[model samples]
Structure formats: structure tokens, C-alpha cells
Target chain A: MRKKGLSLVTALSILSALVWLAGLAWVLQDQFFADNINRQAETLKPDTAQQQKEDSSGKTLQIAAIGDSLTRGTGDPDGKGYIGYLKEDLAKKTKKRIELTNSAIKGQTSVQLLKQIQQPQIKRQIKNADVILLTIGGNDLFRGGQALEELESKTINKTEDVYLSNLKAIYKKIRMLNKNGIIYHVGLYNPFSDMQDSKTTSSIVRKWNYDSANAAAAQPNIIYVPTFDLFELNVNDYLYSDHFHPNKQGYQLIGERTASLIHFREEDQK
Target chain B: MNKLVHNELLKLFRKKRLFVIILIIAALVPLFTYAQYQEVKTTREKLGNVDWRTQLQQEIVDTQNRLSSSRMQDDWRKYLKIRLAQQQYYLDHNINPQAPGAPTFMRVFVENSIDLLLPLLVMVVAADLVSSEASGGTIKLLLTRPVKRWRILLSKYLALILSVSFIVTASAVLSYAISGVVFGYGGWGMPLLTGFSTSGEELVTNTVHLIPQWQYILMEFGLVWFVCLVVGTLTFMLSVLLRSTAAVMGIMLAALIAGAILSNMVSSWESAKYLFMVNLSLTDYISGMATPIEGMSLGFSLIVLLVWAIGGLVVSFAVFTKKDVY
Candidate 1:
């Protein structure tokens, strides 16, 4: 038995050594002298058929949330943001499973968002979403308090013009991606409602929301959900420690509001 | 030389060291398979059986959210950024990088073990190759043979190489046979992407190409075999220099564990890249992970390990031939 085992092991080891040596040679040849022409010719065409197969048998509701930090749940200790709260509320109301793909980046402006939604995976998410949630224009407007420092209507107007066009383009892209999905563009609330320059900031945010709502209105099945009133009265109580992002209670309020809108749509469909 | 190597192999087989290594691998593979099975189960449950694309999309979003935070360490942030780009590349190419299969498990297992677990096993077989003979007073009798001292050492080295190859092969076979029970054995033909390289924080996919999972595993095992051979050679050198097997193991264990720890924080050390332990993660280059140091590539690591192995061989032969046997 010992002699037989010794020979068998030696033979096996020698064979393995040779095979691995071949693999090593292949690695050098493949990595260093890769045929660039073959690689370039192997352009990856996104498999749309498999994606449709995933969509057609979907019993669950695919909710795709894309945009800025609010959609990303920044400042919330739980990191649920408004989307998390909204998901909880929807779960309570609906029997179907809620699968959320939140592709929001914190501090993302409208321009960045336009670029983000253009990514192949993000576009696939949008295409598969039964309902789309959008919360942009915060970073474009707040600029992380830089706008508060530069409270010039001239600069604000210039920013809004660029933002409005981006918003239009984003809406066109979403609509083009999924014709049936309802878009709920969550309007921004003024975190500085109780501050000294509340009037100017509030007006600026309202006008920005108004233009975005108008852009949403132009697209079919797009509903601009109002969140301005939720924080208008107790803005300080709802604001987080940063005095910028919404606290847990504020996210819950936004979540409850969006959940109500989605409920109404479910009822309409029924 | 053939008879000498055969004699060495006989001694090695009589020790049943290879059997123990195989046993160790078999015992550990199931534990990892269970852990991996639990992870996939939980992810599927959390995502409500959504397609992999959505799951990957969610992960990308989560990484983006983490990247947006201010408190993350710079190195960690860079690693995450590179990983995010690689994951995106996988998604864009419509390839499921983590598709569950026995082959996938083997690839992941070998990639993880190449640095530490595997080298330790190789050490077990190699650390006592010469030291035990010396410490047992068998060296005196062996040296009296008409065979040249260098040939004896060369036979020992060849035997070590064969056994190192055997250990790596055992791991690959055992991991696949065991993990296949749970993950199924179908992903051998599954398409995978490789040749992803990183520059700073950017994942350079200009050279990215598709290869089947079997080829990927073969290539990774090749890298694993090379890493183990270097580690085994170093241990063999120590075995020759020391009369105590325990001392050989202690030194190697310290160096390997230190290398594992240093690879985490040595991003700033800049010069630790020359150590063979840090360079043991040669598989990472193939999978396109962020290197421990800024400039360590597969080619760079391969060359570093080769130099060290050559140095170890030279020192082993020099000391073994010249040392006075009591």
C-alpha cells in the first residue's frame, strides 16, 4: 500500500506541476501579449433579453430611487433616509415585496445626476422599476451652504437655468427608459425656514421646486410630490445636527407623504 | 538523481504529511462552504429574489454612499473606488462575477488561501525536510553516501516541489469536491472577466477580456502554485540552516503573519513591497483588486518572489554543502 501510494502521489504531483506551469505560461502570454484586436472586437453588448425576462415575471414592486443625498439617506443615523421610511410604509400597505435599488450619491447635483442615470446598470434599474423616486436639485441649490453665503438672485437664476435644462433632460431619459413607471419627484423642503434669511432661501427653493414640478408635469405619469409643507412649520425640530439634512422624524414625514401618494396610485389601478 | 528524489518521496509519503494536509483542507472547505451558502441565502432573502443586476446595482449604490462619507480612510476609499469600478464593469458587461458554482468557490478559496493558509500548509511539509534529518543525526549517515551533497539537497528540493504541487492540487480538488455538494458544479463553463488593472483610483479595463471559469481557475491555481513554491523554498532554506524544525516554523510563521498584517497598513511604508509575503497575493492582480502598496503589480510581485526564491536556493545550497556535520 505504501509503495503504491508513493508512486501514485508522485505521478499526480508531477502532472499537476506540468499543468500549472502551462497555466503560468498562459498568464504571461495572455496578460502581456494580449491581442488588442480580439479584445476590442469583443465589445460587450448589454443583454437586454435577460433583463426583460427578469421584468416580465416580477411579482415584486421594483422601486428605483435616484438622485442626491436625501435619496441616499444622509444624516439619518439609520441611513434609511426618506426612501427607507417610504419603503417601510409601502411594506405595511402592500402585499407585494418591495425591492429598492437606490443609486443616489450624496452631494450629487443635477448635472451629476444626469450622468448617473445614464450608467448602464442605473438605466436598467430605471427600466425595471415599477415606480421611480427622484430627489435632486438640493445639492444644486444648497451647494452645501455656499448658496446661503452667495444669496445673489443673479447667480441663483443662472444655476436654476442650468438645473431646469438638466431636469428636463433627466425626465426625458426616465420617460424614454420606462413608459409605464410612475415618477414621484419629491419636492425639496427648506431646511433654513427658521433662519434669518428664511424668506429669500424659502422663495428660491419654492421657485426651484415650481420649475421642477413643471418639468415633471410635462412628462406622462410623472407626479411632483410636495414636501415643502412638511418642514415649513417645524424646520428646526426636523433638521439634523448638521442643520442641513433632515432628521429621522423629517424622513418619516417625507416617507409617510410618498407612501400616501403611492397608495393612491395603487387604489387608482385597482 | 532520480533514485535520490524517489528516496526522498518515499520518506515524505511514509510521514503521511500529504494525507494530513488533505484532511485539513477537507475539514476547512465545508466550513467555508457553509458560510458562503449562508451569505447567498441571506442576500437573496433580503433582496426578495431579485436578479443579480439589481443586487449588484444596490451594492454599487451602497459603495457610492460610503464614498460620499467624509470619515473613511483614504486607502480604504481608494480600494472601494477601484472595487466599485470593477463591479460596474462586470455589470456593464452582463457577467455575473459571483455566480454561485463549485468553480467559483474554488477560485475564491484559492485566491484567499494563497497568502496565508496555503503557505502554512506548504511550510508544514517543507519546514522539517532537512532540519529533522540533521536533528535526528540522519544527516551524518546521509552525507557518507557517495552522492554529492549538492545532489542530495537538490533531490530534497525537488521532493519539496512535488509535495508543494501536491498540496495545492489537493486543496483545489478538495475545495471543488466539497463545495460542489452545495453550490452545484455547473459554472465551469461560465464566462468570467479578468485582466482588470488599476491606476491610482481608476480601474483600467482597457485590457479586460473574457475567459471561462475553468481557465480562470487554472490560471489562479497556477499563481497559487507559484506562491506556495516560493514560500516552500524559503522554508526549505530555513530547514537547511536550522537543526530545529520548530525554529524554522516559528520564523516562517512570524514572517507570514507579519506580511499579512503589513499588507493592510504598509500603503505608506513604500518599501515593504519587496517582501515575498506581501507579494504572495499574486492572484489579486488577476482579479483586479487594489494592491497593498501603490505600485505592486503581478509582474512586479512575480519578479520579487522569484528573486527571493533564487536567493533562498543559493543560500540553502551554499550553507548545506559547506556546513560541518557533527
Candidate 2:
């Protein structure tokens, strides 16, 4: 009986080890080789033609916003970045249902945003958008004030060159994915206009805004919305405590300006 | 042979060490649960009247802001990117992030509990298995039996493996039972999103895998079990070589702790990936955590761990059968 019991215990131990080995094999296969099971869940029947017919009665305007923290609505205590406020304003004025998908990630540089545009989800959203809003180039130029302390003319010029080329690539990629949608690239504002070196920083920001606006001008439906003048006089009042992101009132001003631009285009289309 | 194995099992159960492990786990469950409760209260207070969609968006922004600072390390940035992707996913789907409840807490406990605490506890049992017999001079009497020395050593190893399984299962049950009292037993069916890239390169938010909470828990169990098996077998080999239980336990415990510290500190070093302790965290791969080094993968880690386990087993059997008792 004792011998029998020992053999049984040995058999059980071996079996358990085999089970563990099998589990490892299974997990390995699942982790590396398993095709996405969620793909089927994402597939919706293509209904663009049917949706357009329904939209004539009462259309739902689709807005896809991308770029950095400003687009993400950081520093706004109300949690509605400028895009959120813009959605509300556009919905109220147009009296049409508005669907907003904010794909913006905070602190994203121009290169990161360019990479983000390649994601399938972002590409799909951009394709369906009637209007695309973006806020970039702040992180590229400012880099959270690290670039300011170590400012050199050569470095600034080199960085700006890389940024502009990246911006152009981003525009080309978006246009490739979406040809008809109007792209509104919100220009940078000088948050440090009230600082001791306000004059120098202001000049650099103006040059950045001018070059960026020119970049947008080269694209067919792209328009550059300027926020420099809005924050020029009351920089302190428009900025949050961090002195980097805009306060709630500042976002409201931006939202209103962007809405006005979209409003006129909607009227032209009608 | 059966009676010898039974006697070894009896000897392990009679010790106070096993009970101490149980008591410690029982005490930890409620402490973790209360801590989770406090966390949820503060988050809800901060998010008063705001919906989960906006809250998730804010969380993404917060992680991004933290990642922007030059002071942040690359390791932390990688982790933050994963967090950012998860929050982005919740926002995209309009899924209200699950609040800190019993099921969510239990799930987290299963996912993370193995990293340090469970391994330490299991090592205690494994480290004592053979060394104590030698220190107490009981090996002489045990060897005098009709069974061969190899059979005796194998039986002890088998008992240690059994005890490791028991301890792990008990931990799971205790955590589930205790946390269930407060959080309720309703989250088994909730869909859990896994497979967010921790690679700090381009954010690939599209490759996430969705599995139910129950299935995820089962996978975590399997992974944790594999880790414990490797740890237990290795420690048992150490216990066989050392005469004093204290020395065996101390060395294994130090190795376990050091592995954790190295995995955190020099994870960038390619050589660090070959350490068995560093490779113990197989759950990281399943949950899509960033690999400690650049090129380490789930397959690479598993192969490393399996090689160590097999080598330790071979050395243990070979050495114990040949070494003279005198």
C-alpha cells in the first residue's frame, strides 16, 4: 500500500509539472501569435451613404481634435478644454448634433503627434471628421521652458526647422487620410509676454506663428487660427497658475474664435 | 516509500512556519482593502459631479504632464505611457472606468501580489525543507530506511512543491473572501482590457486585447504558479546544500529582494535580463508591461527561467545522491 501511494504521488507531481508546461506554451502562443479577437467587435457595416441621406433631415457633425495639452484642455478646472467648449458653442449655434472625438495627448511634440496620426483608430477618426482641430508646436519650441534657459540662436533655428518639416509631414499624412475636411491648426500664444524677457520671447513666438500660418496656407483646406493677439495684453490673466497652459477664460476665447471660423465654413457649404 | 512521503508531509504541517504564512496573508487582505477604499473616496471627492469620461481624460493629461518633466526617468515614462493608453481606451469607448471595488482590488492583488510578498513567503517554506533535517541530524535516521537517498530527497522536494501550491491557493482564497465582503462578488464578468504597449516608442493603442476578468484571473494564477514553482525548486536545492535553515532562508531571501532591486535599477543593462529573479515577473508580459531591457520578450524570459529551474533540479538530484552523509 505504501509503495502504491508513493507511485501515485510521483505521478501527480509529474502531471502537475506537465500542466504548468502546457500553460506556459498556451500563454506564449496567446501573447505573441494570437490574432486580435477584438477586431470583429470593431467592424461596423459601412453606412456612409445611408448616413448622409439621414443627415439631410438632421445631421450629426463629426469633429476630430488632435495635438498637445492645449488641445487636451489641461489646466482647465472645468475639464472642458477649448475643444469641449467649442463643441458646446458649435452645437448651440448650428442646432445640429455634434460628435467630438478628442484624440489629443498632452505633452505630445510634433514628431509624436506625427506618429500618433498613424494609429488606425486616429486615422479612422480623421477620415470621418468634418473639421479637424489641432494645437501643437508649443512643446516642440518651448519644451516645458527647458529650451528657454539654454537658448541659443543656432539651436532655436535648427529646432524650428525640424518642427516645420515635421508639421508639413503631418499635414501631408492627414491630407492623405482625409482630403476634404477643413484642418484648423491653432497657432501658439506667448505665455511669457509678461516676463522680463518678454520682448525677445514675443518676437520668437511671432516668427513661429508666422511660419506656421504660412505652412497652413500651402495646404488647400487648412487654416491657421491665431491666439497670440488674444493673450498679448493680459497674459497673466489668461494663464493658469502654472503660467504655461491657458486658464478657463482663455480657452473660452480660443473656442469662440475657432467656432467662428467653422461657422462661416458651414454657412458657405450650405 | 509512501509512509516516508507521508511522514515528510506530516513533518511540514506540524511546524509553526506554515501557520505564520497563513496569518500574515489573512492580515494583509483587509489592510489592502481599506487602503483601496481610502483611494476611491479621495478620487470620488476630487471628481465630484464630473463624469467618468472627463475624469479619464483628465487622468491621461495628468500622466502626460508628469511624463513631460525632464526629471522623470525613462522607466517611469514607459509606465506612464501604458497608463495613458489605458485611459485613452476608456475614453474612446465611453466606458466608465471601474471604481475601486472588491473585484477590482482582488484583480490587482492577484496581478501584483506575486512580485515580492508571495515569493518571500514561499521561499521560507522551501528554504526550510531540507536544511532543517540536516541541522537536526535527522538525515541519519531517514537515510537508514529501506528507501534510497535519492527517493528520500525527491519525496521532500515533492512535499515542498505541494506546500507552495497550498500557500498560493490560500492567498488567493483569503484575498478573494476578505475583499469580497466589502466590494461584493460581482466583477467576474466585467470585461478587462489588457495588452497596452509599455514600449515608450510610438503609442500603439490599437493592439489591446479584451478578456473577461475571470479569464484574466486564471491566466494570472497560471503565471504566478509558474514563478512559485521555479522559486520553490531553486530554494529547495539551496536548502539541500546548506546545513542551517537560517543560512538557506537568508541567502534565498536576499537573492529575491536583490532581483527586485536590480530589475528596477539596472533594467537597462542587457546582462540583467539573464538573472532568474529578474525573469520571475512573467505576469508583466501578459499584462503588456514594458520589458526591463530592450529586447527581452515573453519567450526569452520563459526560456531563461526554465533553464535555471532544470539546472537546479539536475544539480540537486545529482549532488544529494552522491554526497556522503558523514
Native-to-model Cα distance after best TM-score fit, residue A229 in candidate 1, in Å: 1.8
- Which pairs of residues collide in model 1? none
* Residues B303-324, model 1: lDDT tens digits: 9999999999999999999999
lDDT of 2 by residue, B149-180 (tens): 88998888877777676676677778888988
Candidate 1 scores a chain A TM-score of 0.92
Q: List model 2 lDDT by residue over A45-136, tens digit each.
A: 22344323222233668788999999988889997989988887787777556767677877899999998787545676687778899999
- TM-scores of the candidates in the order shown: 0.96, 0.67
The worst-scoring run of ten residues by lDDT in candidate 1 chain A lies at: A261-270
The CAPRI classification for model 2 reads as: incorrect
Candidate no. 2 TM-score:
0.67
